[model samples]
Target: MVAAFNRFRLFHWLLAAFFLLAYLTGDGGELLHVWLGYGLIVLLALRVLLAPTKPRGFPSLAPARREWRKPTWAGVGKWLTFSTLVSVTLASVLGLGMVDNGEVVAAALPSVSIDVFGTRNWLGGLGDLENVHEFFANLALWMVGLHIAYILLFRSKSVMPMLRGLSPQGPGSAPKGRNHRQAPAWPALQVSSKVQETPDSCSFELTPPAGEAARFAGKPGQFLTLQVPCAEQPMARCYSLSRLPQPGQPLRITVKRVAGGRVSNWLVDNLQVGDSIQAMPPAGAFTLERTDADLLLLGAGSGITPLLAILQAALLHGEGQICLVYANRDEVSVIFAGELATLQQRYPQRLQVVHWLDRRDGQLNVPALVQAVQDWQQAECYICGPQPFSELAGQALADVAVPEQRIHRERYSGVEPAVAPPSPGRPSRVQVALNGQRHTLDVQPGEVLQDALDKAGLETPSACRSGVCAVCKCRVTVGSATMRSNQALSDRQVAQGWVLACQAEPDSAQLQVEY
Candidate 1:
């Protein structure tokens, strides 16, 4: 029964992807016309055949805060999920009704009015059902508009894993530097040794199993979390996978020091041999969106993590025609410079590495960026950098005529917006659980949970304090906690009472949030 209900999730994502692609890049209207009708019948059939497995409860669509003290905001996510389901449901029902009357012939399906906008004349099987499908398709378009509108008003940086069919890390958790311990949910890449390659940069090679090379399983453009102990502060931080998913070979990540960052400073200054660290299984949606010969790899600061990984994967995968533009302040800050130079020397024909030095050249040369990507008209782009750098790269790609969708990006951490401190007058109480003990504190009303947790001298595990990452998720035992993250939670997870403590506040007096 549980498995059957899970199929709804699987089917929903697959169908959503299919329809999304169709609508975005195909003759979605006509396809949707037929697909909708089929979907309705399928939903019904599944309902009957998998009746025992269907969810017992239906979500309340009514815009009321009865269940929630604050309104459940369901702008784009709600609209997208609901509209896709509705569009497919309506079209499928109408199509089935027409098909049951022998109006649509399987043989005639191919020749039927495929262009929902092509011809009004619904010949043969397309008779009246075409009009009905058209209506639903238009309605679907409205839903799509509504979805976008909702996103515009209440857009979030973190997209939930459930909506996309993949479970992401939880949204919030303990503040920072609280002992967070979890064993390998997957075969973790063990660090054999942390060798000093250079004064500025170090090489972290994973310790393989049975003295074999350890290969991490993740996309070329995906990232993983590393948790090691530090004397000052100890918590895991996200690092881009710098190598493709190698089954048994060692995967590597290069890190440079950041001034005030606890983990970065610790790694560059105090890391040593025999010190093991905990790594969470891989997670992220910003994967190698796709591979194209005409590739543009951009990296600034540590944003180079995933881009370098993608480049390695491209080479290992036998990809050709690539150029990497690495921007840093100077040679002192250039990370993985040696490795990139070696790659350039080896694949001189297919790969080109351009180092943009802030000392010599002011910033990335706009014209050079344009020239680097001109060979392939239909090329895909992958970029990683700080917020400003990434935004600039996006604009540069657009200037070169690359479609918006073709340019993919990944960020381990980002610059946070200014957060106003919570008012001192109105303080609210929140309870957080660490290990097994629950600690409650009277937090300033609307004060960020992380801040409050810190004031109380409780160590909460965290990396990016921004609500985008799920380093702070805890299970809610008693009262509901509000999530301020842009990444919305799913109905099922919400019903299960999981909340991101970083983005949360105590909504109920007796609230309990636990890891």
Candidate 2:
């Protein structure tokens, strides 16, 4: 569900009411019909004119390319919306041209005359203007009827957004920071055990320090950001949890050594059992959206970490079929090969694992990927891998006509390029409102808003601080700010003053934000 502001809602209701009244008046009330048509034209013109300035108030009515490529009920609704807009505009224009005498409504308002194309003869035998006008009017009415039916049948939750300023099923409907509040800012956890999963990868079992077990809980597929103490400075890096999250069980994270990766190399070489490290609570948006639906899991190399978690959880709690397509360079580099084999043997009837080794199969191509998951095209799909592999899997799924909404992708690599560092200057002042409490602080140059709030003990919710996840979103209520990078926010959200606190930096002398 998507939320609509008050202005958009007003325009929506007024347009619907006026169109219905005008269509019903039909040849009986000429005066009322003409006036209603005039009102609609003005409303359409205003909507178009204000769209650039008020983006959130007037969403794009055009059907997206994906809607045309794939035929879903939601796509059909979008096409109907576009059709209705076109038909109504043509009807209004033809109606205006059909009006011959400039004095039709001049008696009521002597200063106004709406004779654009004067007489019906101006059409030059193309067709009767009144008939063409009536045809388009009826077509618009039909398209509107279909649109309403589509909403009531397939998108009932969408109606609330236009009726009120809130969407009952939207992500924003959840209480902000509720999940982050469950854990401390950074809790120390001791490594209980370590296992070499592959030649270059290892898994660590992290046990929460005494009295902090409850703060370490998380859903399957979530990740923990560990503060790695390198020689120069402590760097924060996120590692996916490798096993199902269960109470009283130690949290497990698998780290694969990457060439020139400082944090990954340090953890794989220097970290040992009994060593303690500061870790942020588990956070991510990659968790399963539905447990009952069959799942298609795709992964390559160490990207199998999160998918293993999801597969374990789904097999334990869900009664749905599962298919996993895992790719790796060869048998020696396949992480969790033994564990996957054991699980496949245990749940042979419900789970299927297909390993694609480049040594034998050559590189995984789009056609091969499509063939592997052809039977599960309708299942919920999750893809996690390097950027190239993820893109290939997504293209294969799209080729098979999977609905875009059902396919989720998580990139295991590619941190955005760093923004220019702030110049040396006096620190900026910041005022923050959180959970009904207010606090003031001075934010140093280049300091992120989320870091400042966390240092002040404000507990700002955040996941994927690079801006891929919008868990730390907040509104700028007073002054201006700029984001170093943003991949989660929509254009409408940006226009409405929403910013991702994890990437936001103060651009003025003073700034205020509410969470």
Give the candidate number with the greatest lDDT: 2
Model 2 stretches astray by more than 4 angstroms: 1-184, 414-417, 420-471, 475-499, 504-514
Highest TM-score against the true fold, candidate: 2
TM-score of each: 0.50, 0.56
Stretch of 10 with least lDDT, candidate 2: 167-176
Runs of candidate 1 exceeding 4 Å displacement: 1-190, 208-216, 318-320, 365-377, 412-420, 424-445, 449-501, 504-515
Residue-by-residue lDDT tens digits, candidate 2, 291-400: 54679999999899999999998887555699999999999999999999999999898899999999989989999999998898778899988889989999999999
Give lDDT tens digits, candidate 1, residues 1-515.
22333455556545644554454454436446346445545664565464333232222222222213432443235436555656756755554454322233333565554443333332335567768765886676676566656655665433343345443332122234445432223333556667554465566766534532322355676555666576454465666666666776655666666556767667767765555555654555565533324577878877777788888866654344787888888887777777888988887878888788888888675676676556544655777787678777777788878776566666434432345555445566566778779788876666766667777787665444545446566678876666655232333455688665667776655666677
Q: lDDT of candidate 1?
A: 0.59
